[model samples]
Every structure is written in C-alpha cells, then in structure tokens.
Target chain A: MNIIESITKSDKNISDYKSNLQKISLDKLRVNPIPSSKNEIWRQTNKSKFYRFLDFKFNNDFYYPQIPGNTKNHNICRIIIGENKKIKFKEKKWEIKELEEKEIYNFLEQKIIQSDTTQNWSNLLNHFLTDRKNIIGLNISGKEIPSLEIICNSMTNFLNSKTLLVNIEEETSVSISQINIGDKNSALSISTYFNIGKESVVNHGIISFGNNKSHIINTLNVRQHKNSEYILGSLQYEYDFARLEININQVEGNAKTNIKGIQITKNNEQISTYANISFNGPNGFLDQLNKSLANDKSHSVFEGLIIVPQIAQKTDASQLSRNLLLSNYAKIDTKPQLEIVADDVKCMHGATISQLNEDEVFYMRSRGLTLEEASKLQLRSYYQEIISFLPISKERWDLLALLLKDK
Target chain B: MERKKEIKQPLLEIRDLFASTENLTILKGVNIKINPGEIHAIMGRNGCGKSTLSKIIAGHPSYEITSGQIELCGKDIEPLEPEERAQSGIFLGFQYPIEIPGVSNLEFLRVATNARRKFQKKEELDTFEFEELVKEKLDIVKMDSAFLSRSINQGFSGGEKKRNEILQMALLEPKIAILDETDSGLDIDALRIVASGIKKIANKNSGIILITHYQRLLDEIKPDFVHVMADGKIIKTGDSNLALELEKNGYDWTDEFINKK
Candidate 1:
C-alpha cells in the first residue's frame, strides 16, 4: 500500500476536532499524490531515496527519546518533546499554555488553509500522519521573555510525526533555539508555525542532524505583522536524506525579515532546502543567504523564491545562494527566483557555485601548514560566515569545533 | 703560497636553474649564491623571472623545475614540499598578499611559528605563551595590537599588509628571507618603516634577498651585490652602483649588456 493509505488505515480514535482536521488533510493528499520526477518540485530529488523514506511504518507506540547528558543550561527555558514531554523553567515575564482544540482548528482554517493549502504539502502530510497527542501548541506573551530551547528527537525504525505552533502577543520579544535529532533507520516529519505580533521581535535558530541512513522532512511557516522583526538561522547536516521547506509572509508589510541557513552533505547524502517569502504590503524588507557544501559524492540543492505584489511597493529584498563543491563527484544545484509585480520595488537575486581558491590554499601551505591543514583552515573560514550569525553561544555548543572535528 | 682558509658554506645556492609553467619557460640557466650576513638585490623589469625565481625556491606548485638544484646550507632541497621548505628556513614575502577572511591573524601566526619550532626540536607554545611572544615581536613592524585579533590581511591597507608580512618574517626567523617587491605599493613613510623592519630582522647567521625595480628601496636597505636580470638570466652583477645606474637609465642599458654576452 502507499504511504497515505497505510497512514489512513492505521488512524486511531481521537477527538472529533482533530479527526476532522486529519480528514481534510487526508483528502488533500489523496487528490494530489506524490509528485513524479517530471514535476518541477521534485525534479532534483532522488526517487529511490524518497521512496525508502516513505516505506517506514507509522509508529503508534510512545518511545522515550534519548536526551544527551550535556544539554543542561540554567540561563534558558528548555522544553523536550517526546514520549515524556517536559518543561524545565518558569518565569514571571513569560508564560506557556497549551492550545485548546477550538483554537487549533481556528488557526488551521484561517492562517494555513486559507493562505495556500496546495503549496503546503509537507504540512498537510504532517497533519495527516501526526497523532493528536503528538502536537504541541503554546501561547506565549510578555516583553522580557527568557531565551527558549526546544529539543525534539525521533524514534528508531519508525516514521515519527510532530507539530508545533507558537503564538506571540503584541510587543513581545523572544529568542528560540530548536534542535532535532534523528535516530538510526528512522524517519521524522515536523511542521512548525509561528505568528509574530505587531512590533514584536523574534530570533529563531534551527539545528538538525541525523544518524546513519536516517531521514527528516521539516516545514516551517511564519506570519509577521507590521513593524515586526524576524531573524532565522538554520543548519542541517549528516542526514542520509533531508528536506527543509520554509514559508514566510509579511501580513501588513513594514516588517523586516533576515534569514541565514546552511546545509552540509557528505558520503552519499542528499539534502535540499526550499524557501518562499512574500511581501503582502508596502515597505517590507528581506535579506536571505543560503549556503551549501557538498563533499564525497553527496548532493545539495537550494531553491529560493521571493514575491512582491503591487501593494508591496518600495519593498526591498535580496537573496543570495553560495555553494561549494568539495570533490569532483560532489554535486550542487541552486536556483533563485524573484517575482516582483511592484513597479518601484528593489529586488535582487544571485547564485554562485565554486571550489576552494588554490591561491589561498597555497598561501597557507607556504606559511608552514600542511595541505590537509590548509584545506581545513579554508573550510573553517567558509563556515564562519554563517556560524557567526547564530544566536547560540560558543561556550555552550561550539558548533565550529564540531564541524571541523572530522575534517 | 699560504693555504686558503676553508670557505664558509653558502646559506642558499641556485645553479643552472631552468623552470617553466605549462606552456612557457620563465627562468633559464640562472645561477646565484648567497652567503651568511650578505644581502643580494635582484633588479629586473616585469616578467624577467625575478618573482618566478623566488616562488621556485619556496616550492610553488604552478611551476616545474625542468633542470635545477636548490641547496640550503649544502643540502639539496629540491624535493621538499612548500611547508617543509618553510620549516627548513625559506621565507617568501609576496608582492601581493592574499586576503583571507575569518581566520585570525594571531592564530595563524601561532600555528606557523609552532610548526617551525616543532621541526627545530623546540616545545610548542600554548595560546598564552604564543600571545606573549607575538606581542614582543610586533614591535619589529610597529604594528598596532588590534590587527592581531582581525582576520589575516582582510581589509588591511597596503602598508599594513606589508608590515604584517614582516611581522611574520620576524616571528618565523628564517635563514634566507626573499622579499619580492615589498615596496611596490608603499608610500615613502611605509617604505621607510618596512625597510627599517627588514634591517632589524637581518643578522649575522641569516641572508636577505631583495627583488625590486627601483633604487629608492635599495637606498634604505643597502645590498652588498646588485644583479641585473634580462630574458630570464642575470646579465650583470655589480656593487650598489648598478642600482643607481639602472635608476638613472631605464632597463634599456640591460639590452646592450645582454647582446654583448
């Protein structure tokens, strides 16, 4: 049987509210089956690897996640989403409360379903596969909210699905770090939604990785109000097959959005990222940079789209994609698309794919560094451009060191 | 006749050197010997193989030595890699230093200094110790302490880049230092500063080679021997007067000399 049929057959009894939403999502998937290689959306995707990802059975039993021992930090509020859901801190400036069923239904119908249901296939797929208990929705508020961290892990030999929804009140400011880990032979699907209120600021980071032969499909949808600022830094590596999709909408314009993301692939892995951003009103701004490094016969792909309608006059947007091909067999594909209907808007997009500079490598070698050491130094330099923009602290995670350890 | 005292070993010796890139030969039948405590200046027009000779000595991979022998203190060093040649005390000061972003200058210097120290059987310095040593050496180029924390040569002015190169030379303390057109882009003050730094780093146990096209730099740092090169070979060797003569009359004089040979 197909993945959708299998998921539908395994559906269990739940509240009428959640079951209704799942039914709608299932109908959508049934109408639009998996896209073939001829489809523009899945043209670069490896068909065999995608089929393998969909072959896993849906996991119904709750499996406890393996949390690393070294992930404790007193300065931030931590939340773990797994078999044992837990929240670690309480502060007076901010609060978190679960979303009611009526609230979830209202959000889906208004924001997601009405926006463009056809384009959000990944979110619909997640909604259809995810159990009612696996969804985590929180309403957060306050001006001085503490930094937040969310840790999500997948179980082995199963297709685990989870969803997160966060609603921020007006004038609230928060920094969030989301970490996702995939276990061996596992498949994970995650859908996240964020609503930024007027005059609010959001700093978000997503760091995800997987073990041997693991797969992940992550989708993020964000809505921003006027005068709001949203900055996102994302990184994905070490997954056998991974896809990240991002959708951002400036609701009333006059908002600022900045995104910096990187994907690293090695050893036959395939990773891809697709980002679509729209400026709905006037004076909206966006600066996006996407980078990928492919090594050891791996493949990396990036597709970015920016839309500026007639109402979004005076909008400013720029998108840049930089790729590094580290081996002769490694492959990188990048496409930047801009659709600007506004006559007075300034929009620019560019893409570049290149190898390391030989002159730079030889310069270091003449300074007493071995060839391997020189290459590693150059790689470190390349990784720093994106790493320095991350909100995490080096003393806490030391991501640069982690990236260079194997090299 | 009284027996002649044994001659001291030359610090660097190049004999019958012939080198080329993929389709063109750049250096042809060149010979030079540099002794301890002596400074040699090679003056030539553009593309006369001055910089190519310096790069060949440092083991640049672009050029192949068709028939040549490079000896360091009487030991053949033609087979050593660039880093090994550096660890064996050969330094090349580039005319245009590359700008490397995101790599700390101090960290690079520490690693390079320690690499040479390890080859010389000396214990490597930790971060703290290396910082102290580097600060002491910074005075040789009169560079500010702020540049140490920045990326190597990224956004540095031309003079600052040259000074940084000299600071590296001081830290590495190579036996044979080849400064290739170090005064090309410098103003009078920067040239004076760079020349002073080079003079300070020169010692009795080390030799210096300056490749240039003008006599202004030679005025600051005097050379014991000045060699005029044309068509990939040294056509004339004389005292410091040759540099003054070339400065007065352009490279046109070298054509007559080459034709006579």
Candidate 2:
C-alpha cells in the first residue's frame, strides 16, 4: 500500500472500540477504550482530548530547519539546509535511508511485542505499522569525528516510515543532537529508532519546536548491548499537542540508560508524553528526569513507567517528574512509576508539581523588582537546575540561555 | 518615580490608621508622624500594632487596611504595591527576616540597588563600582564582607541577618525607616553595633521610625521624641525622657503619666 492509500485506509478502518483478540498494531488504539467512564487515567485527565486529536490532519512538505544562529562568537559547526527534503550535515554522517522490503514487512508483522501494558501497542501499529520503510543505521566503526550531528528536516507532507537503525562501533563514542524546527503553526508526525553496539557510548539529544495549533508524535526505539551506555535528552517548545513515545530495550546486562526530558508549553497547548524502559539484562541502571512548564492555560501530561522483569535483577533505576504551573488555568499530570518483579532490585520514583515560590517572589519584589522581573529571574533559576546537567561548552550554554530568554 | 519633585512633608504620617490580619485588628486608628532631622521611638506592648504597622506600611499583602490612611511626604501611599512603595522610599527592617536560598547577597543587592537606580534614572554602579559600594555598606553595617558572598539571609545567625536587613535599608536609603523589633534577637554587643550602624547611616534627610518593645534600644539610639503605644494607638508623646520614665515604670508609667497629662 502506498502512503496516500495507507493513510486513507487508516482513517477509514479505525474503529471506536476493538472487541476481540486485537492485532498488535491495533492495540495502539487502546488509549481510550469503552467503559472509558471507568478509566482511572482519565479520571483526572480530560478524556475529550484524545477525540480532539483524532481530527488533526498532517501537512505535506519537507522544511529542513537551519541551525539557530549564535550572536556570540563560537567554534561550533553550522549545519544549514534549505526548505527542501535534502539535508547536509558536515559534522558527521548518521543518515536515514529507505528500509529493505523484507525488513519493513518483518517489523510490520510483529509490531506488537507484548509484555506488560498494551495500552498504546495496537493503535500505534494498526495505523503506523504498515507504512514504515525508512532505515538509519549507526556506523561508528572506522573513521571517528569530533561529533555526530543529525539534522532532521521537517515534513511538509506526512509520511509514515519504519525501522530507523543506528549502530555504534565497539568502544567508540559519539554525540548526536537532532534539532527539529518547522513552521510556527502546523501539524507533524515522525518516527525514529536507535540500535547500540557493545562497549560503546551514545549521547543523543532531540530538540524540537512546533508552532501553535501544531501536533507532533515522535517514537524512539532503542536496543542496547552489554556494557553500552545511552543518554537520551529531549527538549520541546510550543506545539499544541506534542507527544513523545520512547521505548528502551536493554538487550544486554551491565548496560546503562539515562533519559532526560524538558518541555515548555503555552497558549492552551497540550503535551502528553509516554516513555517506557524495560530490562532484559541484569545489572542495568536507568536514571530519568522529566520536567514540564505550563503557562497560558497550557496542559502537560507525563505518564512514564519503568518495568523490571523477574530475571532482570541487580537493576538500579529511578525516574522523576517535576512540573511548574505558571498560570491559574495551566495544568500538569505528572506520574512516575516503578514496577519491579525482583525483590532485591534498587529502584525508586517521585514527582513534584507546583507554582512559583511565593516567598521568593516577595523577596525579589521587595528589592524593587517588578513581577515580570521576579518571574523571569525565578524561571532562569529554575532552568539552571537542568542546564547545569547539559554537557555543552560554556559558549553553547550561553547561546541556549539567550534563546530561552523570551521563553 | 524616585528623584521626582521635592517631597518636603513629614517623612511619614500614619493618620487614624486601622489595620488587621485575618479577623484580629492590630492597629485601631493609630496615628504618628516623623520629619527629617529627627529620630522617633515608638515603644509599645507586645501585642500592639508595632510589627503589624510596619508590615502595613511596607504594603504586605497579608495585612488589610480596613479604614485608615498612611501618607508618605503628604502623598497617600496606601494605594501602592509593596514593591512600588519600596521604590518610593519606604523601608521595613523585619524582625524575623526570611532566608531565600539560591539568591546571592551580592546579586540581590545589585538587583535591588539597580532597581531603585532604574526608578530614579540615576547612574547605576557597574560591577567594579558596585563591589566597592557593597564593601562600604557592609562596613557601615559592621558586617563582615564575606556576608556578601552568601545567599540572602540563608544560614545566617539572628544578629547577622538583622544586620543584613539594616544593610539593605541603608543601601536603599528609604526616606522613612521603620525598625520593627529589630533589636529583639540581638545580644548587648550586637545591639550596640547595630544601633550605632543605624545612627551612622541614617542622615537628617531620612526619618528614623524605631519601634521597640523594650526601652533599652531607645537608650542606646537616643531619639528626639518618644511615643507610648497602647491598644494600637499612640496615647502619649513626650521628649526622649518619656522612654526613660516608661523604662523605669513600665506600661503603668505611661498610663498614669498620660492620664495626668
């Protein structure tokens, strides 16, 4: 099936509710099932939002974004591309290509690999499983570069592809940051995949900005080997309905994973993120910190769970979700869960949701600071907590700080 | 805006000022006034409106002014926000100062001083100049210069924090200074240092309104006038000798003396 025919079929055959033993791809639609009135997740969350997103359509065309310019002098490479699908990254090569026919069919055939929750498995596959045909493999073997920068161009037209692969060399290391930028007001859909090698380290950062009235759904699938380290960082701004789906598979023991995410939304925007980390190997460690800021009637939802299998012992993992509600109407749904089958495992989870500090506000204002000045100062201080964790040079840090000034 | 038209009225005027927090009316139609070139001592009982009055004049949102007016230099300042009133030259030396973590004292002082300077459209001190200015002010407060490197009021002792609060007031140079129980948590030595610092920094251009529950501070920092506050109102005003009389006789001293006068 082609892209248009496939999308048309997906738009047609999607049922309100699935009855019997649902197909793996169809399980993605398990988001809002019937007796939905009794859904616990929807008790505090507005259930109508799922239906509102059903009417969103994708825009067709590819607009590769240019790197944000730095007014200050810096030594970083500039990866600039035009308003076309063609992208040229001079830093390093980690490009996505069309997947083989067999590879595409195999992934689509087994779209649903069941374990614990089938909440998003069926629907995601039923709609997205078939059309995936893109493949990006990581080749960090022979030649080494300073850094591996993957500049992904935006989609003017919606296309569903599958099986993007990344293979890192054994004992080799590289850092990749995909800067996603598009028009200020548009809808977008994208998928990404990663495959790690043994004894290698991977540093990946996904930064995206979607305009108002826009929607983004990104999926990341990773497979880690023994002694490999993976750090996944994501930052999103704007985007009315922004969603990120992260699936981490620890295929080997002694591997480590760290996932850090930060999102800032305004203007009645809604963002829901679902991330899952599974352990297939023992002695694995996972650390994650997710923070969201909601202002101007915006809403943010962070639903994440860490699953440790019975055999996956000696695993040390933690997840934290923090949110700041900037306005009275702004809302946050932050829940972090730890599901461990092993009794001896070391795992913990916690979350915090709050507004700006009143005493701090008063302290700042008492010093002749205005409300806006005080709030900005507090915001800068708040972001500093995470910015301190970023592994960028002072120059890059300053540049990012200036970009987030108005933010 | 600061540095605007000359304001030559009494530095502060609290006229029939009735204030409350929650349902408790702390200031029941109290009135007091102070002009430049003079220090006024307001000695009151523990539950009197001394601190509440200080917070009200500072425009603390928690305190409500039911039916009264407070004017600064003849202009009604009751309508302004706390920060606006602060920028308009009103300072409150809190007895129980707050410790705000993460904000360095230097950064806080610079931001505060620059805010006032911004309001006044006066030349602001650059980094180098600000360091010198802060150093001088720290000495004026008799505080160690290392305090500037610490967070605002964080981990500071009672005396150090109070001295820092006074340091901020001196740096801001508000027209009216209300020291609310400032000497409550200080030792004899700390009190002497703090009282002398206040006396040294406050010029005749600024009116010092000192509120204390004890007459000890009044003795150390001699005032031109002493007012005895009772039931949220000042019922007696006399020369500095009134503080000595009240010190020797307690509340009944002012009560009997006022009843006779």
Q: For every candidate, what is the interface RMSD in angstroms?
A: 0.8, 1.6
Candidate 2, B104-148: lDDT as tens digits: 788778888877877778888887898888888888778888899
> Fraction of true inter-chain Cα contacts (below 8 Å) kept per model?
0.69, 0.41
For all candidates, what are the clash counts? 0, 26
lDDT of 1 by residue, B48-92 (tens): 899999999999999999998989999888899999999999999
- In lDDT terms, which candidate is top? 1
Judge candidate 1 at residue A72 and give its lDDT. Answer: 67
Off by over 4 Å in 1: A7-18, A84-89, A109-112, A115-118, B1-7, B259-261
List, for all models, the DockQ compared with the true complex. 0.76, 0.39
Q: What's the CA RMSD of model 2 in angstroms?
A: 6.5
Q: Score candidate 2 by lDDT.
A: 0.69
TM-score of each: 0.95, 0.77
Kindly provide the TM-score of model 2 when superposed on the true structure, using C-alpha atoms: 0.77
The count of residue-pair clashes in candidate 1 stands at 0
Pick out the ten consecutive residues of candidate 2 chain A with the lowest summed lDDT.
Answer: A80-89
